[model samples]
Target: MALVNQTGSVFWSSNKSTTVVNTVAQLLDNGNFVLRPENDENPEKYIWQSFDHPTDTLLPEMKLVWDLKSGINRFLRSWKTNDDPATGDYAYKLDNRGFPELVIFNNETIHWRAGPWNGKRFSGVPQMKGVGIMRFELQENSDEISYSFEMLNTSLYSRLVINSSGIMQRFVWVEGAKFWNQYWYFPGDKCDNFGECGPFGICNANPAQMCNCTIGFRPKNQQAWDLRDPSDGCVRSSKLDCGSDRFLPFKNMKLPESSKAFVDQTMNLSVCGEICKKNCSCVAYANMKITQGGSGCVMWGGDLIDMRQYDDSEDGGQDLHVRVAASDLGMFSIAYE
Candidate 1:
């Protein structure tokens, strides 16, 4: 029997001969299935390669590639349940927003975002630091965008899996303990909730003030904001003169959602800011580098989304320069400094 859906299709076979085999061997070490010719060394060139066909787990050395020209992307789809291998509602893919970024989806809705790749890790995932047992990479070109990881030290076995609850987790295999140790998981807290604070609003889940508007901006609905409904977001306090507007530097912050931004790989931060200022729609700008001594720039032209304040001591976050009325600059200058 076969069932077809808008985004995916499924097929099933009842015959035992067609589905099962007696000589097949499954290896847990490499997650590969192979069939051998009695005494052959290479196992008949792999009857089934798990790398070609993936479920919800992404193992080391396996590539998650996308072809922009063909509109084809390869990524992990969560299983319906622990017992069922059927595709679930959640999916993980590299999204071509303003810049190429990693996004998790629950059906058509965005479940969470990893922000854009800033020459290191995703801007939103600052905790993915330190010399780990695995090294991750985000590759992008005119043809495609792909996410892959490699084992830095072979002795330390690590794996990334999308669980039934829609959380992506990294686990390390402990040989001595004979169990998997949890390393990290996505959606760390309320701040990790996708677009929780709505457009132009920033969320700092574990902060004295969890949600607030950016500098030079004010809550669109003060009543709604007091009631903990930040969906109204923030709006500019005063109109930008466009001629005298200057970018107010905001240091030690996580960049806003990239989807609303305009990006140019060739431009530096200063030039990018100038380009944004010239346009009345430009709201903010940030460097593309995710490390110390950052370079390049990503500029936002619309409302900022999915922004949060992060603990700089735990993760190396970036700074953002937000546009403001030149007259209002003096009022907020001390706070920014």
Candidate 2:
């Protein structure tokens, strides 16, 4: 039998090859709504489920992914309005152009970026580090890259979502209050907006001004910069010389946009730097995995984009080394060894 309600019948299945039989769909107390064989109660045998087609909420063990060949994905789209269940202006999606990064798009433009993953969590979203109750996992394979989280205690309830206003959030159910309390949310400040400081710019909300160009960079449009509009981004203060360029190390930084980076899972950090120094097109490089003492490398060949400064006192940051002009390295009083 199909599921019917006052609104009408809603059949939940992403696979067209599925056939309906004597099965029952049950919404478990753990927030999982599953459809399984009528005679088989074990969840591992579930043939179809609403959890797989999550509209806006991400329950425990649910995943957000990007696939190149199959194009199958489970992402969140904002509701059109507070009163409607229609598609809206923003979409929370995982982009795998080069490496994988979680991005929120408004119409076809990037509105917010969670930054690329650095093994443990999204490079920019230090807050995503699961607390005592929640545990997180990220997996990248030959076919796809995905992120998911599980509850350390199955009895507790937690959910993540891309809300209508283009913000990503996580909420936890408070049993006594019988409500979901906001655990955290993203795009929390002006600096959190996608590319807020523009190319080669690093944003820090705590600073008097959130925007500043990185070493060896200058405003692309000084006129627009004076008007407080940095969308024009930045330009390198000097041209890169592949033969003698030096790397400026920034600790506890959210790495630049990765869609244009060259990713290789086999190279170590030393080899990554050597290879990057040999490529005149390369601008920056960083380890892909922070765990296991680091494992992969992503070398950005295009203009570095969407970088931000994180409060190092908090937690979870990556080390990024960007190729710089020899004179610029001298500005920091460091030898270009």
Candidate 3:
């Protein structure tokens, strides 16, 4: 069967091998296009669904997923142009590496990241924490990894889209205004750009100098850093002394990139510190869940990338303990014991 437009052009065609006499197709209120037997209304028994194959827009309840067992990745890709429905250069998908996180890609390269889920919201998007209209969820297991959000009020309309210019933004219907209003946007500032300050550098959005080395570290290229170029990142001012190294407490921090991370949900903050202390490669650590006094452990073994410092007044972000040599700690170090 095929769906044709007014111009007699076939926009969609079904290739089902067996045809049922009483099959029916319906457009659900949640934007799902489902094909099922007319007598059956069970969504689980539907033969096929448009939600399983997404294009540019991600409406409420639509999942952005990665099937670990089958290697099938369902994500949103932007249209080439406002007038063109062809595939564009930007894609928003769930990136399952050391830990699962939402990321926007410019073609195949990472452009922006929403950080990892911390039991509440993405570590980088603190705005998701207290959202009253939307409830976000992230599920990870042996079979698959998925990220999705649902509106609390069924009467409301909202959507998340990766636009042609590579910007990921969320919009909500303004019933009174008779138009869609942008609710949120990623790459909100220079600091939101992936690895904006390279590795071991913390980006602070408020200052004239937006990038700086974390406590106990120094710019790898002092001359370049002085010239407002921090692409070279930073290095330890003193070599790590392994067992004798101290942790510098960086409060209100966006956890670093976790492409090479170690996670232990059963561990606590103190034990997590000991675990990192024992492993010479472990450079930083943070609690995986920030609610109810915090819990779990996530440690980074290599250069800490894509980190940012939030203002003390900011509602989102967690504390991160960065390993530094005892001699380099100076006044920046906080007592970990």
Candidate 4:
């Protein structure tokens, strides 16, 4: 038997006994369902609750936690279909690899990445404008790594769900209109496609452009690039002089993949660039921020991957610094100027 509590109480039983006593109370204010003890005034002391067993949607008070020691990962997985509640193929989970970023995956393949967690929000999710209608928090300690959000207004209804197609969406319920309004969607554009541009390539979705080589670099396969095939990526125009190379600031750019890159959050951009220059294997370097008080650096050892242009008019965008040979730097500067 099952019960729903708040505005109306519902009961369902498979047995013949009419005295099957399973009560569910629905709280209209919080949208909570509590399995209560008989004639209990306080709903807080319920025996069982829906908040503890969330399926795909994370309610206001629920914690999406991950416990590495216990092997309990509590991220959301898409449903099988719109009509089915069964689990689907896509899942959103925290990647504890380099700097602890959030990754959405289709089975074993990464579909999208919400870049490393800065002090405030995910570096990749520039959509989080500010703490207005909602606020998010990431709690990481010895026991758990969890993320949760709460609406500033209790009466305002909002939900985050992962659809069966591996898409994450935010929805708001309009009580006056009696409809659900879509607020946001993950994998917002082509740039969100994991490694859409192959190694050593950068995708600039603004103006709807495809992959382009970094300064001082050219397509490894010039013919392929001319044919609109960016999978070939790019190659350095000349070998890095190491001592003579300069770090060119690619202002307002989405940072490249960090899993394969060497990152030191403690070092400033200048210091980081020096370290990269000292290593022959290091191909590029960049500051962790495009804004003021920017600290920390990410160094690319191999080829760069999954870079995109910044669209500050539409999305919150960050900048990156790319290293290049002195001659290439001069050429790029002259051409742009």
Best by TM-score: 3
Stretches of candidate 2 off by over 4 Å are 4-21, 42-44, 67-69, 331-337
Please give, for residues 1-337, the per-residue lDDT of candidate 1 as tens digits: 1235777654532112323233444454656544433344464445444575667988887777778899887888998987787899888877877777888899889999887788878778877767466788988789888898888887778888887778999888989999999888997887788988887787876676678886678899999998888888888888878877878775556677786567776678778777878987787888876555667778887677888767667564567888788777766545542
Find the 10 residues in a row with the least total lDDT in model 4: 11-20
- Deviation in angstroms for 71 in model 4? 3.1
From the highest lDDT down, the ranking of the candidates is 3, 2, 1, 4
Residue runs of model 1 more than 4 Å from their true location after superposition: 1-29, 32-48, 331-337
By summed lDDT, which 10 consecutive residues of candidate 2 come out lowest? 11-20
> How far off is residue 149 in model 4, in Å?
1.7
- Model 2 accuracy (lDDT, Cα): 0.81
Candidate lDDT scores, in order, read: 0.75, 0.81, 0.87, 0.72
Model 3: runs farther than 4 Å from truth? Answer: 5-10, 331-337
What is the clash tally of candidate 1? 0
Could you tell me how far off, in angstroms, the CA of residue 3 lies in candidate 3 after the best superposition?
A: 1.4
Return the TM-score for each candidate structure: 0.84, 0.91, 0.95, 0.79
What lDDT does candidate 3 reach at residue 100? Answer: 75
Clash number for model 4? 8
The best-first sequence of candidates by TM-score reads 3, 2, 1, 4
lDDT of 4 by residue, 1-337 (tens): 4445675666543222334275545453555555665676475756656665567787776777778789787787888898998888888877765456778889889999877655566766777765478887777777878887889998797888888888888898899999989888889987788887788787777654477887788888888888877777888898887777776666545666777767676799778867877887787676554446777787777777777766667454465656678888775554321
RMSD of each: 5.8, 2.6, 1.7, 5.7
Model 4 RMSD in Å is 5.7
